[model samples]
Target: MQAPGGAILEGFIDLLVEDGDGLRVVDYKTDQVALKEVDERFAGYRLQGAAYALLAAGVTGRPVTRVDFVFTDSGEVRSLAGAELAVQVAEIRTRLERAPGEEPSGGGDDQLRLPGLNGS
Candidate 1:
């Protein structure tokens, strides 16, 4: 997908399921955080989910209503939808537009990096 700054971003989503509402993106994680720690762990995964949501929506031309982050090690499920998802997507787009070091923090994307995602 094309970011706000005209950088192309691409990645594979773990899973996609369509229901009455719309498409849902599910990403499996091994963070090993317990259910009680979900809130903390969930924050770090939001932008990744948002990116998946945007890509899925663009590719299928369907609204992405939800994103699910499943913590395999802890058997926990965290979800992002509605307003929260929108906020994260917007935040990620803002980061995508900025040049590498310009991102305030969590700017290291060693997990999955797109060549021009930092608007190179």
Candidate 2:
């Protein structure tokens, strides 16, 4: 599903592996990078992965315990699971919810509060 601001909030997954008492969400990455780069962009990609995990969890109801970001550029894949992704999703959701309304924020009738500003 896409959010009001054109952000996609769901996606598909490749595999759901079960490890006896635990589960794992398998993903693929084709990027070439180190863990440092991944750490830097955690917030950038967390939403996308969390969206996928949420959708998957809704369908499975087993709690998506893992999220894998397989970068297709450097063969480096990162994972953010459990509470980490949850926090990211929460942050994103909060930001989205608190975002400005459809109306713009600057330059409006109220902005002309100063006297003699309209060539009067």
Candidate 3:
């Protein structure tokens, strides 16, 4: 999928459901956690959810108004919609457009050093 900013996105969505309202993207998570901590534990997955939503919308020609994270371990589902969903998508696009030479923030001694890259 080509993002509005011209970035090419490629991935497979676990599932996409079409209904009366619009497209819904579902990503299954197997993380073991209690229901009460579902939101906190899955917070980092919002970007992935948004990406799936964008991909589904592009493929189906329908607006993706909802993104769901289904946690199989605890049978909990978390959703992002409306303004929050838009924000997450926008953030993901921005990250994708960053200059290639720019290092991500919080760089430290623990930075990963791949073999034969950056003189490693």
Best by the lDDT measure? 1
Across 3-77, the per-residue lDDT of candidate 3 in tens digits comes to: 544455555667788856898877777758788888776786777676677777887789998888889999888
Q: Count the backbone clashes (under 3 Å) in each candidate.
A: 0, 13, 0
Q: Higher lDDT: candidate 2 or 3?
A: 3
Ranking by lDDT: 1, 3, 2
Per-model TM values vs. the true structure:
0.80, 0.53, 0.74
lDDT of 1: 0.74
lDDT of each: 0.74, 0.53, 0.67
Candidate 1 has its poorest 10 consecutive residues by lDDT at 103-112
- Candidate 1, residue 21: how far the Cα is off, in Å: 3.3
- Candidate 1: list runs displaced more than 4 Å: 99-111, 118-120
Best by TM-score: 1
Model 3 residue 63 lDDT score: 92
Q: Which regions of candidate 2 deviate over 4 angstroms?
A: 1-9, 19-22, 31-36, 72-75, 92-120
